[model samples]
Target: MDAATSGTEDKTPHRFHRSLSGLGVIILTLSVLSPGVSIFVSGASILQQAGTGSVIAFLIGAVVCYCQTALIAELGAAYPTAGYDYAAIGHAMGDWAGATTYIATLINMPVFLNLSAIGIAIYLAPFGIPLSATMITFITIATVTALAMLNIRANEMLTGIFMLIEFAALLLVAAIGVWHAQPDAAVCVLNPVHLDNGVWIAASIGIIGIAVNNSSWALAGASQALMFSEDMKRPETIGRIILIAFLLTVFFEIAPVFGTIVGAHDLKAVLANDAPFETFLGQYLPAFLLKLVSLSIAIAIFNACLAGFVGLGRTVFSMGRTELFTAPINHALTRLTRRTDAPWVALLLLGTSTALATYIPLTAKLLLLSGSTTILTIFYVLGVYIGRRSGRTGARYRTPLFPLIPLLGVGIVIGEAVVLWLDAETGRKSLFICAGAYLLAFCYYRFVLMRRPGGWKMRGPDDIDALVARDVVDA
Candidate 1:
């Protein structure tokens, strides 16, 4: 055991070595955000729904995402643990709320992994990769799971390398648009028109609002940085890292999206193609370069899956350290490999689950709701409120403007939930299904978990002062 666990009585304590630099953490965060794939997917969806007005929608989504940063930064700084959102909420609110939210979030991890892994076939087909989707998914799961089992720093360097290629793809897209600067390109942002029944017409505010809400998916992953809090070489810098990651994610995702919008030679033709970004690039670039960009998309998807696997493994490891589950499960989860100090058991379990889930054909709406900002953002807002009310905001970093940032986040997400409820076809059904899942989770927490011995106790870095007093390492 390291010096951090020397005095603590708990045996087999699951600990993370503070070996990840702030830049490494940022790279991992961006990898999880996956600007390249998000541009191809969420960006294309926004273009289809709002057309040129997608630029405005992206800006609004960025603003909405920014509002939650304060809550994240503040809580992250206070409880710099791998448990992430659960740790912060557990400390601020209570054990039941934290564990329930953790359960809900954990159940959704495979949905994202399957979607990202399944998407590899879409991008790689252009590169003449002959593998079927099932084969590709299995290969991706095995490869990323192996990489995730490496020491955190090794994974960091690998992800950084992949991130460079990802950014290059985005930069190429932005450069093409700037080079092909259209005279009426400004109208795409200002006037915002969509082709309606073969005629160009101004987009309505409601259409733009829907686009903005959808764009939230494109910009949502920066907060994944909080999952690496305990691994940071300097945890105090986490707030700054999260803020920088958020801003950079907004820029990188928006640049290529806007570039594709303004740089298109024929807006109608580009929008009509299902793969809008690839179609736009095909018009300008040589075949080899187009294929190279397509290859970058595949790499980006793999990088995202790898980074997400690492985060999810650490999250489970944290829960195990806290002894939130049965003793046997906790013992298994906390078993880090001696050589790498990596959570191999947890990583393997989640990896196998994701690999199995790839065979279960799920609807697009279900996947979308799984990653929705509505419920998770509600926990963040509550964490902030409870933190402030209980005077638990004594971290190195604090949210500016008191509660304004979190409250705004709450308002925006609740509005998003309302939008989901009203849209019967696309979102309402998913909301109803997600509500059932959430209700079941709550019941599990209240009826089952609370009745267990010691009752869902969570151990984390909630009080730096106490750690200092006891001369125990916080990270």
Candidate 2:
């Protein structure tokens, strides 16, 4: 297909064109961020250290996420596209940075699905479902692949419904915990003596970092809403949607942390055993209610996996469109059935990769690396820095405090990186793995891939100028 005739102008398949409301955006955000049961389980160890300060850490993490959201919101308002980090980082930093971001995202994609698959198994274990690890893995892969093949509008509806169920289930758990609490419930919150200032402060800071880090999983694809900015009733409305999503995620993260601390005295022991949320529910709620919570958590994991697949597919599609990958992939992505413009090939690749990763036990490590890579890519939003520096004026939404918020975001991420470096067992291995992945990508792009027929050249200043001119002309 010729570039002009490749349906780039009609990128939105008819099925994908339904406008998403601010509420839909919030639900999507919740689906992405509210892997409530999974997150609670993962962070249990960290929260134990946090003591009463766990709540403080979550609040701080929320603030950091808010800053990053603001930075992303500004960019989304200006140049909303599907491959968010890929596009923003590429545009701001350079081809190398952008390509590295894409690689990281690609690696992280399967890891996210795998994590959700594990979550599904854990959620189902208490009900005597007894799914094998391999069975759960394949099921997750199949479910995500089937969902990705559906129309975008249909997927959005599914996301909204599942997210609502998740929110309801979580609220139910919180209420049940409160209702079934012993008189000593006050002791959980009111005991100042239980909180050692020095320990609490240290734990709080660490937990805050963990929370911020984990928010990447929670806030994974909020930017995808902006990808459909061109299809929105009003593009500016995307900003409000993003803000609402951020606020909802903050609430979701904080509430469960508060609930768990209130209910469990030995948070570490509870978390170490895994499925702490289910355990808590079993201890306090009726059997039927406990079952419901467990089921809801499984649904939540499915929702998260679905969201991850959608975002991953779009990122690959966008990369292909820009000729960053092999032209064959781009050709396939650009091809649309009369029925839909969906990039079926990209979707298939995404599903296949995720399925293949299921056989490996590296999902957790990959997730950590992916999260770290994501934070690193935030530096590409130098658009924030450039916009502030040049005093560029536009109708786009602006982040508060100009460069200060972005700077803080950079500082916090660097601090996290330092902490990871200090803990070589986790951080160093991840760093090396990421570095190795990038090196391979670089070699492929430079030596083998770039030499292929119809390979894309890196965009330079002249290309940006031409793009800007075209935008001006179209506007």
**C-alpha RMSD between model 1 and the true structure:** 3.1
Q: What is each predicted model's overall lDDT from 0 to 1?
A: 0.79, 0.59
Report each candidate's C-alpha RMSD, comma-separated, in the order given: 3.1, 4.9
lDDT (10s digit) by residue, model 1, range 1-475 = 3212333524534567788889989999899878887898668878888889998999998888787766777777666778876777766677777777777666677777878888888888876668787898899999999999888888888989999999999999999988897888996779988877767889998888888887876787777897887788787788889889998888898998889888998889888778888889988999899888888999999999999899888888887777767878877787777667778888998899889887665775364453346777787888888876766644567777776788788788777887787787767777766666667777878887889876766676434335522422322
Weakest 10 consecutive residues, lDDT, candidate 2?
A: 192-201
Total colliding residue pairs, candidate 1? 0
TM-score of model 1 (CA atoms):
0.93
Please name the candidate that would achieve the greatest TM-score relative to the true structure: 1
Alpha carbon lDDT at 98, candidate 1: 72
